[model samples]
Target: MSLVSLILALLVEQARPLPYRRVVFEPLSRLADTLDGMFNAGERGQGVLAWVLGVGGLVLAAGGVFAALSALNPLLAVAWNVLVLYLTMGFRQFSHYYTDIQLALRMDDLPRARQLLAEWRGRPSDGLSSSDVARLSIEAALVGSHRHVFGVLLWFVLLPGPCGAVLYRAAAVFAEHWSRRSEDPAFGDFGGFAKQAFAVIDWLPLRATAAAFAVVGDFEDAVYCWRTQAAQWPDDGLGIVLASGAGALGVRLGMPVVEGGEVADRAELGTGDEADVDFMQSAVGLVWRAIVLWLLLLLLLGLASLVGG
Candidate 1:
């Protein structure tokens, strides 16, 4: 089911991609905001309560959709899952900006790249170097990959199904969306909570991503780098992925962000060869390896279940 949905969704997304600013994303964005407004109360216990209520609503919504499909025709569940994941999954959601920034850097269009990187990241990039441009790009991609793909995949596998992925991804988007708007007093405190939640939600996938980096890159170095250097980042998993990637691509990935500048890693990341398709190649390879590893494991697990049964 997982493999089928992922493949179908990815194919559907590629063949007829939806625009990011489309009306579809707007509702999801609104849904997230509404949930946050209802739940995040600046108290730990209340926050948990909020999460419970918020997640409950989300789950109920998914169940309603699933039940409706099941009633109409069980086969329709596939279409439902496909549609849900089509909107929820895919590199296209965040990678377009990644690709654009990379292209801007490649063409030495630093101003355009800076403009773009700033908008995508909600930070100033006016003084970015090729490497700063590259580092932040990689950092964003690393985190985005987890939220957009791995985290979603994990939730889908762990919960009732892809609905879990939708829930988790929604949570992630809420965190990011809220944190970015911290200047508003109403949202200021939400950043801490959102960032914290995103970190906890992302922990498992980050490690998995690091392991994938090791498998596809300079195996020993990537592993060693991930183990040692990754812990240095503000985001534990972010640290590992970037560190392993730095070792793998031989391109330095970040300086520490301004002390306490958010969960972001880079105060003054070191410079290196410009980030390029090769880096994207390595990232793509790592992602595919993770997917293959997971699919094979699920297949074997299914086979074993059949044998045991």
Candidate 2:
């Protein structure tokens, strides 16, 4: 079932890629916001209530959707999976910005490149060097790939199959979203709660991605970097990705990205980051290699299942 659903979903997704994304998350996001508002009535226990309100809501929602679709028709269930997969798994979510910045760099346009980075991160970019910009862009792309792609795949494999993909995606979104809300006088506790829950959600998959990078990129260096640096990163997943990607490309990737005032998405580049031509090439290679490795692993699991059956 996993193999067939993956194959079918990929075929359909490839055939008709979304032109531009619409707000598929509005309903869920609104639901989360509403519950959080009511339960997060106090500052002290607010974090606890927000987690119960946000994650608890998603678990119920995804399960309900799966149950309803399974009852309606198996094909309908697959369709539901496709909808979630379409939103969850794609590089376009973050890569288009990279492409624009890369184009700017190719023309030797430093300021423009910085602007792109700043806009992405919602920060100003007056101090970035050309190399800094390039390095930061590579790091952001590498991490975004893990969060938006590989992480979702891992979660689905472990849980309620493709529906788990949706759950994983929701978990990621809320984590990033509400965690940032920690700064908000309004939703601060909700954000903090989201942060904790998502940290738990991302713990294993982040390591798995780092391990994948080590195996496919430079086995010794990637592992060495992960062990040495991953422990130091505030977020385990982000640290593992940066360390492994730095080793994979044989470049420095652990430079601190400037944090914007808000709980801005640290998983991406802010403005003023540049991309090295060589590092970009290597980053592309690392991603494709990782993809091949993941597919092979999936294929192996499928084969093992067939043998057992």
Candidate 3:
């Protein structure tokens, strides 16, 4: 059931991608803001409570629906699972931007590439070079693939019904809304728990993603970068992913970039040549290979369970 649901969701997503921001992100963002407004008191406890209510409530609701559907009809439950997975996880959620940026760079249209990348990142990209554009796009692609697809799939497989899928996505949304505001006094400890909570939730999945990238790409350099260079980046979890992916692709990433007329110093990852259009294509292939590896594992697991039964 899990295997079939995931495959169908992927196919449907490829055929017709959802308008993610309008459909999924906006509603979830509103929910997170509402929860924070009602529950936040600039305290860690309040933040924890808000996160629980926001994230846990969604998880419970998804699980309840799945349970009810299963009781009524097994096919209904599968359909429900497919619906939730479609909303929560898919490559198309981020791939269009990546593809457009790749095309822009391929045509030597630096401005268009920067525009696409800026839109994708939701930030200014006025000063980035061609290499900078390619590098950042690859990084975003790697992380987005994990967050949108691999993490959701892993959790969905680990838990009953679609509960885990909802849990992972909801938790991630809350973290994005609250966690990054830790420095603001008004949002103080209200975001601390969210940051930590996501860290805890993402710990295993992060490493699992890194390992899969390594297995599907260059094994030795990926492992080496993961072990030696991952810690140097500001966000340790993302560092692990970028490091491993860069190493796997044998391309350098994360160096000083000219942003807002100032150089943003960043620790470099990977051990080989600098990132370019070619490596950007390589990154896409690496991500697809990782996805295939994950599906193969799920297929094997389903087969094993059937044989055991």
Candidate that scores best on lDDT = 3
Q: Model 2 — which ten-residue stretch has the worst lDDT?
A: 264-273
Question: What is the per-residue lDDT of model 2 for residues 41-89, given as tens digits with 9 covering 90 to 100?
Answer: 6464775666665666666777688778889898787776767677667
* CA shift of 16, model 1, Å: 2.7
Against the hidden reference, what TM-scores do the models get? 0.80, 0.83, 0.97
**lDDT per residue, candidate 1, 1-309, as tens digits?**
656776787788778766655644567567657766776565445555555565567767886887788789866877778887777766676677878887887788888887888888878776566656666777787666666666677677777645777677666766666666767665446456555776787777777766765666667777666766666676535776677666655556666443223444453221346565456555566666766776677678778878999
Alpha carbon lDDT of residue 174, candidate 2? Answer: 65
Give residue 160's lDDT in candidate 2 (0 to 100): 76
Name the better of 1 and 3 by TM-score: 3
Whole-model lDDT per candidate: 0.67, 0.70, 0.91
State the RMSD for candidate 2: 4.6
Clashing pairs in 2: 117-270, 117-271, 118-271, 133-273, 133-274, 134-274, 134-275, 178-191, 179-191
Which model scores highest in TM-score? 3
lDDT of 2 at 90: 62
